[model samples]
Target chain A: MVTRGTTTATAGTTRTAEERARRVAADVPDPELPMLTIDDLGILREVHVDGSGHVDVDITPTYSGCPALEAIRADVLTRLDEHGMPDATVHVVLSPPWTTDRISADGIEKLRRHGIAPPGPAGGAHGDGRAPVPLALTVRCPRCGSPDTRELARFGSTACKALWVCGDCAEPFDHLKAL
Target chain B: MSGDTTSERSGWRSAAEPSVERVRSGARPGDVSGLVEYTLRLGDDALILSQRLGEWITRAPQLEEDVALANIALDLLGQARSLLTYAGEAEGAGRDEDALAYWRDERDFRNVLLVERPNGDFAETMARQLWFTSYQYELYDRLRASADPTLAAVAAKAVKEVAYHRDHAAQWVLRLGDGTDESRRRMQGGLAAVAPYVDELFDPDGVTGGLGAVAVDPAALREPSERHVDGVLDRAGLERPPEPAHVARGGRRGLHTEVMGYLLAEMQHLHRSHEGASW
Candidate 1:
């Protein structure tokens, strides 16, 4: 049987199921929402290998209806098959739910680099100073180096993003909300 | 032996706590059908609107706006898939997403007429989005507490997405209404065009009435939906059009506008041609 960190017997080194799954998932980028990784989004839930060497991967959807899911599943299967686990099954799970909190810190940084602000902490930050306006706040522009930005819309290209425009650069960017 | 062990453990656990047993026992087959129909209505609304938005993909005035419309459409499609899948399973219909989506005729669809209307222009699209998403957000918020676990789960997830959609439409409504004279005029016209169809969404139907305990009453959703829409229109400096004199219905019973048949034909053509085919 294959282990978590080691490669299979036929391979060079033995790898654990989680490690194998993570390695395979590393290649499956978020299809539509490209800034984040499947791992980063917490969609890559679990990977396991049976005694027969058949691999099973579990994934959850970011949103119930995102069409990119089919493409992601295909990518996962293709990547894993290339990695030597030829018999692989990708299962979709819906329990425990996917939350914005699952987004990794590194993913947030990557999103910022792409010009989209990472979701802010849930229930705005606490400050002793008078309660801040719930709506208006400084959002750094993704395209131009400008803080003079206004929220154009709370919804952006996808449900995951909000629309914001920078007055200085006259560019509109998508802001990824903190789930 | 493993199965026996798991079942024994569950039985012992249930004996120790009667609440779990009560919940299981309370579940009836008819309740499942009710839940299925209720979920189908929600799915139909999302699916139809998503298709309408998809029409704007290449035609949007600006490139960025084009991407924006496609993204919204994707989100709606996602919700539709989940709702339909859940409904299928609950009903024991042996239908999957593809079957529900491509197999159904126009008359079988339960979406509101507003969603299936043609996308006239950017303003018209925004007007529909603003009105529909506002109503959806409110409906899903209340549905979060539905007696059916699956419905509640779908609502809990969709509520967040619809909230963003509502906010997106709200901003555009404000911009167009408060912008130049031309923009304001288009916004007002768009509003007038879509206003007539809003009443049909909240009207009660037989399935909804039968599914009352497990599902949300459409009539109950009307008040909050109206309040939310009115608030947005008021803030946008727009007038609410008078409710239409005669409201159209029958979507739940599969009767739809002429446009629905064309939309369905395009969506289902390939699937019907090659039965059970997959990419």
Candidate 2:
């Protein structure tokens, strides 16, 4: 069977299930934004595996109304099961709510390459006696690389995205909204 | 709107009747101090308003508006789901979010009258949204400090969403309210229509009194809520509609407007029809 992670010797064990399980879980693509993996999207919060191979994964949804959260959870489990993991459970945690800034640089590049505009920095600090105020950033066209994009709609097909039209290219695209 | 049914007049009905009884409460068990009641009030507000906003899906004036409104609706629905689920668990009742949402009768709903108000027109929708979200922004901002961790967490997430929504609604109020005379008149009329129902939102009685910091005092929110609305109105060049002589109240105690029945009928019909069905 194909292993999910690099087999590294740890203590007395050849390779730990936790490390393999995490890689398997992280490789599951986001159902909504398929170009990004759960790890890239920063929703996969925690993963743990016991000696017997029972696994627990923690995830957070980018938006409270995000319908893809369940799908994402299922995809994680299904991928784990397919990768030889049997006992696994996904738990959703809401604290320290997901913000767009959590999206990795690779994920941002992936989104740009996929024709969806990545989000700007959500806020400066988290839980620092501040909430995210509306921060207007100049959105550039992912295709033509023009900064003259105008938002066509504040809401898009998904809760965490917005519809925008690039002024220069005249192409409409999905923008991951900064939460 | 003035307390058309003001006197907290024993609005409780026997959950004994009907098809939706499967969505029944455990005879208000474990809810004596009204934490469940408090939680349900917030949840029902989101649920009912979300339902109203969803009606604009295809009918909105513009395609962009349709998406915007629906997105807002979904945000509220998400908040409702969390709050309702929390309420169910706290009440120690078996009811889940769906059961609470799809099973309650009109009188059983603890949502304020403002939300259940008809979606009169695009301008009216904007007006109601501005007032509600302005109030909600302030409420959720303060609610983050709630002693109840779940409520606090829900508020922490929701405060950000409603901030976006509140800004969206305020911009519309400014746009339509300050536009053409025709647009201005309609926006003003919309404000007037929703004015009477605004009072019920800040009613401080019922569940909140005993709940301490776990519950936000509606009284504490009134000043800030109005200040925000008034500031928006000032920028929009729109006059604040005079307070209606009759302020609608009693929703906190479960007495709702006449339209609530129709709204509930539409919302609860499918679930009540297929009692235990799930996809």
Candidate 3:
């Protein structure tokens, strides 16, 4: 079973085929945002290995009809194939739908480093991935670390991002939307 | 179009992997036909509305609104894909999401008349969205407890989405209604034009009629939908237009307005023109 905060590198158990596969698959960068890996985005739901050594990976999407999921799947396959697992399956899960809260702290750092503002805390503590609360946060500029910024548009180049312009830096950047 | 990700080679099904169903992790619906009919309505509503929303991509009043509306359209398309896939599974018709969306004629569509109504003006579009999103918010909220796991899961995700959409449309309504005299008049006229179609959304039919615990009764959603929409209107200092003398009907029975034919023709044209083509 998969639990929160569990990643391939953190699961320090006896190395199994699944664990090795998980580690390899975890490093596959999100196709849309190459700076972030699947594990970093929190979309890699579960990695399972059957008794016969068949591997299966479950991933969630940032939004429905996110065109990136297919690319991410192919990237996962390519990574797995490179890791010597030629036959693997990728499945998409919708329940406990993907939330910005799932992005790892390290992932958030990576996003900031890559000039993208990370989402604010998961809607608010009581949101529980269900409630409809306004995610009103004062986003800091990823470039100059200035707290002055304004949302240019709610939708960015991709479904998961919102376009924001830094007040101080005057640079337009994408903010991973808090959903 | 050039950098398409998913390959059609994945196909719809594979004999080697029996566990990989279209809607992963969802239990097979109990009453297949009931679920099919019910899901088709949900899917069609989202699908049709998505196509209409897509029309505003570069044509919205503002660039930000263009991006916002496109985002909403993409979200709706995603929801429609999942529901349609589930509908196909329940129907056991071997149809995929694309087939269900592209192949169906206007008369075969089960969407409410509100969504199929053309996007007249900015105010008019917002008015239609206000009503549709409010109703959807209530319907999906109640549907979270559905007997069908697939429907429940879909609703759980959709409930949050429609909330944002509701907020977007509500903001537009408030702005347009309280703005300049000309804007206010336009907003009022938009509400009146869309008022006739509002009644049909809450009218139950064969699909939503008797599904036990699995389906949401359209009639049951009327109060909350009205309350929410009416609250937004009240905030905007606008009154609800009187119900039209002639209520539009027959959407559930696959009877659509003439605009639907033109919409379908445009939506399905490319797919029909080149079968089995991707990207």
Candidate 4:
């Protein structure tokens, strides 16, 4: 039996097909929102292998109407196919909607590096200078390490984000909303 | 001992509460016509406005702004789909989202005149967005507590989305109004052209009264909507136009502006031709 939740695959270990497929899929990143991996966004639901060595991946959209879904599907197919999993199917699920709480800690770091702030915690506003915000306070400037940032527009380049301008660095960036 | 155990089981079973079958039923036709009509009206407003916003996809002045407008349009389209689908199911007409969207003629659409207006320029689009989203946000807020559970659910979801839309438009309105002289002039002109249509959004038709308990009275939406609009105007340093005398009417009953037919043709062309095609 494969050890669940183990970060590393042991040397000389015989891994199950499902585990191998998942390890391979770890490389698939979100196409439009490149900062977060599909798994980190909570879009990647499951990865499984069939008797014929085909892979099936389930994904859920953040919102029912996102156009990026089509692009994401195509990207998944391309990535998996190139990884030698030629027969792969990407299934889109609608139940149990995607939420910001699903984003992993590593995903937040990736977003910060990409010039966008990861979503703050579930229901608190950003930087009102209140109690240490539970949902990750301190939106560091993607350009410079400055916490002095203000919202420019609640809607940003995409539906999932809002525009923010760093007062110190004078650069604008996107803040992923805590949906 | 076995006999005693069986007797105890029987006694407990008899004492337990009877199973109640509570089925989730769709909205009834006549009972929810007003509510259905109201939902369709809201859906049409979003659909038409979404189409107008979509035109800016590749044509926006900047690449980022282009993506922004397209994203906003996508959100509106999503809201429209849910609202329209719910409305069709409630109508009990065997209609679905596509049927209602593609099969309906121009006169069948119930959107406000304001949303049907053309997106002339960036200024015009921003003016329209400011007016319409402000109105929609207020409308959704009240509708969240609607008697109909489905309507309430839809409103609760949409309220969060529209809040963002309103904020985005509000920022642009202020920027344009406070910017260069030319920008201010264009903004003023855009606002003037769209202001007359706002009157109809507040006007109540007879359908709202008929669906009394099941509907949000359109008349009731007037005061709060006006207050919201006034707040946006104040922040933008713009004055509200004197309410227009002749309110545009008949959209609820299928009478529509000249542009409706063209819009329908484009929106429905594919579905009408193929009958059933899935992406």
Against the true structure, whose DockQ is highest?
3
Residues A1-179, model 3: lDDT tens digits? 35544554344432477889999989998888888898998988678776556778877777877889888888988889888888899877666656788999999999999999988876443244245545647899999998889978767788778899988989999988777
Each predicted model: what fraction of the native A–B Cα contacts (within 8 Å) does it retain?
A: 0.26, 0.40, 0.39, 0.16
- lDDT string, candidate 2, B47-146, tens digits: 9999999999999988888998988998899889878876776665667787899887777888898999999999999999998998898888888787
Q: A62-135 in candidate 2: lDDT tens per residue?
A: 77787787789789889999998878877665666678888999999999999998888777533442453545
Query: For residues A78-152, what per-residue lDDT tens digits would candidate 4 score against the true structure?
Result: 877877778887765432335677788888888888888887776533112121213335776777878898876
Per-residue lDDT of model 3, residues B1-279, tens digit only? 212112211222211222235444455444567778889999999999999999998899998898899988988998898888877766766787878888988878989888989999999999999999989988988887787766777777677677778878998999998899999999999999999999988998665666878899999989988998899899998989986889898888899998999999999999999976788
lDDT of 1 by residue, B57-170 (tens): 789877767777787788788788777776666556567767889998776788888898889878888888887987787677777666665566567667766765676788
> In terms of TM-score, which candidate is strongest?
3
Q: Say which prediction, candidate 2 or candidate 3, comes out ahead on TM-score.
A: 3
Q: What interface RMSD, in Å and to 1 decimal, does model 4 have? A: 14.9
What is candidate 1's lDDT per residue for A145-178, written digit by digit as tens?
Answer: 6879887655466656778888998988888765
- Clashes, model 1: 20
Task: State the local distance difference test value for candidate 4.
Answer: 0.70
Q: Comparing to the true complex, what docking class would candidate 4 get?
A: incorrect
lDDT of each: 0.71, 0.80, 0.81, 0.70
**Model 1 alpha-carbon miss at residue A158, Å:** 6.0
- Residues B1-279, candidate 4, lDDT per residue (tens digit)? 656332222210000111011002433334556767888988888888888788888898777678778878888887787677767765766677777888888877888877877788888888888878777877776766666555554565566667667767877888888888888888888877787777777777777667555556666767876776678778878767666666676666677788777777777899889987767
Q: Which window of ten consecutive residues has the lowest lDDT sum in model 1 chain B? A: B8-17
Clashes of each: 20, 4, 0, 2
